[model samples]
Target chain A: MAQGNFILREKEYLALQASLKKLLANSYAKVVFLVDKNGSLIASAGATGDFDTTSLASLTAGNIAATGGLASLIGEKEFSILFHEGERDNMHISVVANRIILVVIFDRRSSVGLVRLRVRRTATELERILRDIDAGAGKEEEGDFEELTEADIESLLK
Target chain B: MSFINYSSREINCKIVYYGPGLCGKTTNLQYIYRRTNPESRGKMISLTTDTERTLFFDFLPLSLGEVRGFKTRFHLYTVPGQVFYDASRRLILRGVDGVVFSADSQLTRMDANVESLENLQVNLREQGYDSDRIPLVMQYNKRDLPHVASVAELHALLNYRNVPEFEAVATTGVGVFETLKAIIKLILIDLKKGGR
Candidate 1:
């Protein structure tokens, strides 16, 4: 597998959920999400029912990718954090573990300072969990696809 | 790269459409988006300029049913094909699991096709992906045009890997789904090989 590929087992999923939950509580944010740089939603917490998380994940990844490109042109490695303030809501996006994106959506109830402080602590925890997931993926020999056959794959598309 | 979520029994993969300016990469995606069942497709987003040219990229999420009790989802993206958008194109290729090189079949655009194909290889290398190793499908689009190159010529020019190739007219939906299915199958096959 390529270096950025990963499998999220139940153990790491639960840990990620807990950390995101804590961050949402501490910062009084409406929602928090853990998305891969490729725009896959790993986990999310808080009020998520109103928004379409799949689109959010894809757009957030695009935003980060574009920002990373601009940073490179200006002779920087990457812009680690991005904040977008809307009239009624605000978004706090950060890069965690160099491969995952941490997103927090908050309203006037949560200030950027509070969110940033809480995110700093949660980012470290998330990074540790992501590293563990990578390590686990590396230690495994075979994947669930070992039992997958060509017929099975073809049938799905059909 | 693909993401396997055991917790959700889901597999998510990213596939990119690459080609030169005005080569119908976005048209291919639009055809699929319109033909797909509403339940199996999500919102399609296109970041385009005032003249309707792709500014950054276009994104569409799709569900390809389930395999072995695990649902398969594909995120399709089209990069800006203009020459100056190289920076933006490179950004969209990050973590891509498969690619569909949409080559313009017009005889005059042959040089553009070769240049874009070479650019694809270079960008893939920069992203730590070997173009030869990645799951790729060739799409020779605009075949219905008056002045077009032969499929043999297009293949000779762009199909160095001799991968599965399709002749498409994206506007009228000819060969759109065929091209998409070929790439999806290749990606799944690669995944079955432990993503090697």
Candidate 2:
């Protein structure tokens, strides 16, 4: 099982951003984002400025988790992909590498078929980057937090 | 799980508020949401039933300025405390970095409080976290209510690990930030020691 905590270095972060950008462009989606299963917004591209990406990431994760629970109740591992259709827009949410969630939002400009195809291709690249991240996890430069003090934490609350 | 993104200069941590039903878990987050500055917080999302009980979870995203140049973001969550929502509660604990166990202080809720704490431990273990090792704080909520248990009684019943404990009237926002701050401090200390 993969540990929940991990560090995302600049190298993999840029790679993830590039992959999301390409998926957004190819799928003709309004926005594409990558979120950790824990609901942290890792990276995003496209028309994210118009929406609250934080809430979007969180709700997406929650939706996936709830669906996953249902899947297990029926003796399935998980429902890797979920779709929600709205009158004006649609959301395509899928689990990548069983850890990260890939979300694409689109409207009349795209179809589910196109989004599915684009996500399939991008999911591979995303998984590769995630593996790279896992391989290099915990190897970051140390001592960054060694000097941290309780006073420093107190200052933030102030 | 705590995600440290060096590229974005941000550290994101998930802290969950857990307790039995009507123990003021949601009230704690609501209080923080209302008191927080608009610029430092994101929209608060509550997935509740028609009757307003939490059916899934309540999420609040907060930015606690910065620590050592990296922006610190804490995503707060409250699990549905009703017993039947055990599965939903387990999902919310998937990647939790810390937990604030909100214990209702009413004398009659002692059994409920004990049961909820045990549930929290079992769920945390299933998610690969050791109950004792995880960063946890105890909030004795609804302190102002009539016929409440004394702090000593509540502590003796709920806090076997002897973690930091606070008395809170969550409806009035009293001790809300104190509980939150204590958990955050423990999480940061854990991170410095290499996160679990």
Question: Which pairs clash in the backbone of model 1?
Answer: none
Question: Where is model 1 chain B poorest over a 10-residue stretch in terms of lDDT?
Answer: B187-196
* Model 1 C-alpha RMSD to native: 1.2
Interface RMSD, all candidates in order, equals 1.4, 2.1
Please provide, for model 1 over B50-72, each residue's C-alpha lDDT reduced to its tens digit, 9 standing for 90 to 100. Answer: 99999999999999999988899
Winner by DockQ: 1
Clashes of each: 0, 1
- Per-residue lDDT, model 2, residue A111, is 99
Question: Tens digits of per-residue lDDT for model 1 on A48-124?
Answer: 99888999999999999999988988999999999999999999999997889999999999899999999999999
Candidate 2 chain B lDDT trough over 10 residues, lowest sum: B187-196
Q: lDDT score of model 2?
A: 0.93
**Clash-forming residue pairs, model 2:** B1-B95
Task: Compute the lDDT of residue B19 as modeled in candidate 1.
Answer: 99
TM-score (chain A only) for the predictions, listed in order: 0.95, 0.96
Question: Candidate 1 docking category?
Answer: medium
**Which residue ranges in model 2 land beyond 4 Å of their true spot?**
A1-4
